[model samples]
Target: MNPTTTALRAGCSRGLIELRQSLTNAGELLNHVLWPVLMLVTLFFVRDVSFGQSGFLLGTLVLPSILGMNAAMALVTMSHLLTVDREDGTLLRAKSTPNGMVTYLVGKIISVSGGLVVDLAIFLVPGLFIISGLAVGSVGSWLALTGLLALGLAATLPIGAVLGSVFTSARDQGLLTLPILGMIAISGVFYPVTSMPEWVQWTAQVFPIYWMGLGMRAALLPDSAVGVEIGESWRHVETVCALGAWAVLGLLLAPVVLRRMARRESGSAVARRRERAQRRVS
Candidate 1:
């Protein structure tokens, strides 16, 4: 077998192992379950409340949007994980092995993307029951949901990897949460973008998160619910174009950024970081 092919296979195996570990470990399992559980509790409270005069249950509108937002959260997850692994010398060790960098990236993608799918299921399965407005019985709804999810992931994950490569420390990575939260606030995760100020709507439209949420809403909400969306339409073409642009840009940039970051990894650098981390902990 070609060396790269062997590395890819090994990477897939590593990803599976990591995925299994994440699911089985008590703390990691709790982490996986926690957010969805919280979201469900929130949904339980508002499932009956109607949104403004739109006559749509707030929970129904929010459910699919939450799904889309979570898909976009793939960016933060990938970024944070890469930063943590680099800090722990995992990247350095990979640099020492033949074809290791390729395998390492593939493994990380598998682990992150696999974990995300599980997280989405955790939220989506029960959400389907708790929310009422979704077009769950239709094949077209499911197909649209699946396509938006794929596009959302493609649009965010590579950019996340690039961001991860740029940040040198966990502290800096944590700071990223603030901007992400701000984006979510403006991205119509909890409400309609059309309800926000005009400038806010335009700003939200610039990010993949807004397009993702809009795509989900288009997929799951009843056609009548379109009354609350911007221009009172699903705008599928714009959603695809916006997400496609991000996907292309991220795919183009991630490899170059990752390669630069990987080249900077060394035994001495990793050792220094470890020492500093230990000192901080102590």
Candidate 2:
């Protein structure tokens, strides 16, 4: 086989192995289940509450919006894993091997994206049972939902990888969570963006998170729910444009950033990072 093909296969196998381990590990499994379960419980209590005079159930609106937010979170997960791996000498080990960076990245993508799919299923299945007003009966709805999910992942994952490459440490990674939480608040994960101030709506639209949530709402909510959306429509074209722009920007930057990060990884550097981490723990 060609060397590139060999590396790709190796990376894929590595990803699958890691994914299986994550699924089977008790701690990791709990991490996957806990949040979705909490969200479901929240949905259960609010499933019947009306969204003001919009006549939409708050739970029904939140279900898909949360899915989008979770999808966008792929960015954070990718960045977090990259930082951890770098600190633990994983990136250095890969750097010493032939085409190691390629294999490492491919493997990470598979594992992260695979884990995301499982997480989504965990949230979505029980969510469907708890919420009403979903447009799931039609084949088109499922297709659109799938497309939106794919676009969402594409939009966020590269940016996440780029973020991971830049942060240099887990402590820096923790700082990112605050801004992400703030974005979630303004992005309409649990409520309609249209309800926010006009400037707030525009500000939310500047990031991929809002488009993701909006796209998801377009997919799962009924036509009647459109009234609560910006422009009183799903704005599918704008969603595509926004997510696509981010995808392009992230893809363009990730390689450059990852390459720079890889260049700086050496045994002494990794050791120093470990020492710092240990001191923090102590």
Candidate 3:
């Protein structure tokens, strides 16, 4: 059998093992259930509230937007987990093995993306009951949603790996939380992007976050809701283009970034990071 093919198979098995472990881990289980449950509570409260004069329920608008935000969040998860593995010397272990880095990355992407899918289902399933007015009954809605998420994951996961590569420590990765939150704020996950300033709209468009949210909205919202979006349209073409571009960029950058980061890893470096972490704790 081919070495690369063998590595891919190993990576897939590794990812599944980690995912199963997470499902059983008490802390990990809580983390998975918590956010989506909170989101459902939020959606429940807003189910009847109107979004300005748009006649659309705020809950309706927010539900899919939350889905988009969650999808984009795959980047954060990928980066955080990678950084944590690096700090704990797991990455160093991988570097010692043949084609281990590639295996490591594939496993992480699968683990993270799998977790996202579970979280998405948690939110979306109950969310359909909690909110009214979304186009939930159609096959098209499901197809659009499935495609958007697949693309969004493809778009964000490698970028997350790049971030993880650049930010060598968990503390360094922590610094990104604020900026990501700020991006979510402007990405119109919690609100309409058209309501933001024109410059804000343009700036947000440059990132995948906005496109993910837009894609989610297009998938789940009724056609009438398009009036509130930029250009009074869902801009499906633009959504695909923006997300496709990011997907390309991430795929291009991840290997280069990961290879560079992997080359820099050593037992001594891992020891130093652990020492620093211990010092911080003390």
Candidate 4:
């Protein structure tokens, strides 16, 4: 068997194991459940909300956006995990092994993506009970939503790996959250992007969040709901094109970044990071 194929299988198994561990561990389970529950509560309060003269329910619109936001956060998860793994010497261990970087990254993507799918389900199940305007039963809705999710992970995880490798420390990794929060604001997760200034709309479109939200809405929303979307259309082609661009850019960048970062990892460096982290905790 090819070394790459062997590494891929190992990564898959490793990811499934980590995912199982997270699902079973009380602390990890809580981390998974908390945010989705909070979003559900928020939706409950605004289930009947409408903006301006548009008759669409804000909660219904927000439900899918939250799903998209959760999907997009795969980037955050991948980066944060990479930072933690670096601090703890996981990357160093991988660096010592043949094809380990490939194995490690593939595993990380699977674990993060699998966990995210669970989180989305946790949100979507009760979410359906809370919001009524969605076309939840449509087979087409599920298929489109799944395709968008795959595309989203493709767009985000590589970029995340690149960012994670670049940051070099847990503290710096935390800083990445600031820009993500800012992106969410403009991405219009809580409301329609059309409500933003034209310049803001253009800026948001440059990032994957807006397209993710738009795609989610397209999947779950009724055609009539497009009235509130930009150009009063779902713009499926635009969404795909935008996310595809990000996917291509990220895929192109990740290997070079990860390779450089992996080469930098060493036991001494990991120990120094752990010491710094310990001192901070103390």
Best by the lDDT measure: 2
Score every model by TM-score.
0.97, 0.98, 0.98, 0.98
- Distance from true position, residue 211, model 3, in Å? 0.8
**Model 2 lDDT tens row, 175-223:** 9999999899999998888889989888899999999999988888888
Model 1 Cα RMSD, 1 decimal: 1.1
The predictions' CA RMSDs to the true structure, in order, are 1.1, 0.9, 1.0, 1.0
Selected candidate, larger TM-score, 1 vs 4: 4
Runs of candidate 1 exceeding 4 Å displacement: none
Residue 71 deviation, candidate 3, in Å? 0.4
List runs of model 3 lying over 4 Å from the truth. Answer: none
lDDT per residue as tens, model 1, 1-282 = 999999999999999999999999999999899998998898889899988998888899999899899999999998998999899988888888999988988898888889988988999999888887688889999999999988998999999999999887887887899999999999988878888999999999999999999999999988999999999999999999999999999999998998899899988888898898889899
After superposition, the stretches of candidate 2 with alpha carbons farther than 4 Å from their true spots are none
lDDT of 3 by residue, 36-107 (tens): 999899888878888788988888898999999999999999999999999999999999999898788888
Q: What local lDDT does model 2 show for residue 3?
A: 83
CA lDDT, every model vs. true structure: 0.91, 0.91, 0.90, 0.91
lDDT of 4 by residue, 7-98 (tens): 99999999999999999999999999999999899889989988768888899889889889889989999989998888788899998999
